[model samples]
Structure formats: C-alpha cells, structure tokens
Target: MALPFLPAEHIPSMFDELDEHGDNDRLDAVMAYVFSIWINRSVFSMECWSIFMKGVRTKNECE
Candidate 1:
C-alpha cells in the first residue's frame, strides 16, 4: 500500500533536503525555521501549501 498519510516519492526528496547537511540537529533547526515562518503567517496560498507540504512529507518520513 502507499505509505500511510503520504505518497513515497515526495517523502524521499523532502527528507533528502533535510538530511543534506548530514546533521540531525541542523535538520531540525531548518525544519523549525520553515514551520515557524509558516505558522506566523496568516493567509494560505498554493505556494504556501507547497512549502508546508515539504515539511509534512519530512515529518511523516521521520515518523
């Protein structure tokens, strides 16, 4: 079955970006930056959704 709550292909790329620095702490910090920015914003757009989905995919794969 497709991975629960996520499609597989996107997951790898998302995690790949997060892991590119080869440090989990750096990855977490970058992720927190992205999410904190999104959360502090009010309106949602397709562009925002795409960016948010990157975080979602990474979060799911990490789980």
Candidate 2:
C-alpha cells in the first residue's frame, strides 16, 4: 500500500516552527500528532485492502 499523505497545511508550520537547535516543544507535539494520524490511516487502509481481497478470493472459490 502507498504511504499515507499528511495534510498540506501542517507542512509549512512544521518547517516554520523549527529552530537551529531543533528544540521546539510545539513542533515535537505537532509532529507526534501528525505521525499518529498517518500511522492510523495506513493501518486502516491495509485492513480494508485485506478484507476486499478476502471477499474476492471467497467469490472466486465459489465459482
């Protein structure tokens, strides 16, 4: 499956929030949030694909 795409709006702010020391707490929080969402979507997509494939196989077996 393809990787999950994050929302475009979050991209700019994440870059803007970064500092030379890379010590921005808010950026870390935002990144964590976005990462969690991406992970969830990827897993959900895989599960859906598995279900669809299972249905296809069952239908083919019955034919």
Candidate 3:
C-alpha cells in the first residue's frame, strides 16, 4: 500500500510555527509532535506489512 504524502506547502507552516515559537519551545514541540507521528506511522506500517506477509505465506502454503 502506498503511503499518502504531505504536501510541500504544509511543511513550511509547521516549520514556520516552530521558528516563531523560538528555539527551546520549538525544539520541544517539534520533537514531540514529529516523534509521536513517526512512532504511530511506524507501528501502523509494520502492522500492515505483517498482515500482508501473513497473507502471502498462507497463499504460498496452500499452493
């Protein structure tokens, strides 16, 4: 399955908001937000791959 990509325009504002908040606050918020999203997506993708591979193995075993 293909992952939906974020648009380029959306990226600048996230960075801009981070910049406006200054170094400390921005760093904390950015790290928290980015890592949260990253972890969630990583888990989701892993689950998807696990299911897909299981399906493939089941099909192969039947064949």
Candidate 4:
C-alpha cells in the first residue's frame, strides 16, 4: 500500500528539515510546530477537507 499524504520527494526534504536542528529538543520543537499546523489545517477546519475532496474529485474526473 501507498502513503496518503506527501510525495516521495517531499519525504527527503522533511527528513532534512528535521535534521537541521542540532538536538532532540530542537527536533521535538520543530515536529511540534509541524503537528500544530497539521492539526489546525486538517482537524480544525472543514474547508481543508472540502478542498482535498475537490482535488480527489478532479483527479478522478481526469482519469
């Protein structure tokens, strides 16, 4: 099975971003920030889901 979010190219970028910080504390901070953004954009708003669904619909239409 394949992953849902993020393309394979983005995975390396994400790991690089995580590695940019010096220590575990800094890495945790970065991850926390990212998690907060994810929660706010994905869980806190219906608009995000609506937009994602639209994208899926468009892809399906193309197919």
Q: Which stretches of candidate 3 lie over 4 Å from their true place?
A: 1-23, 40-63
**RMSD each, Å:** 12.5, 12.3, 11.6, 9.3
- Which candidate number has the best TM-score? 1
TM-score of the candidate numbered 4? Answer: 0.30
Error of 4 at 10 (Å): 11
Deviation in angstroms for 34 in model 1? Answer: 0.1
RMSD of 2: 12.3
Alpha-carbon runs more than 4 Å astray in model 4: 1-23, 43-63
Total backbone collisions for each predicted model: 0, 0, 0, 0
lDDT (10s digit) by residue, model 1, range 3-59:
122443354455446446555776678656654553335564324344423545454
lDDT of each: 0.46, 0.44, 0.46, 0.47
* TM-score, every prediction: 0.31, 0.29, 0.27, 0.30
**For candidate 3, lDDT tens digit of each residue in 1-63?**
121233333443554465566659757776567546643454554333333223344546666
lDDT of 4: 0.47
Candidate 2 to truth, TM: 0.29
Worst 10-residue lDDT window for candidate 4 reads 45-54
lDDT of 1: 0.46
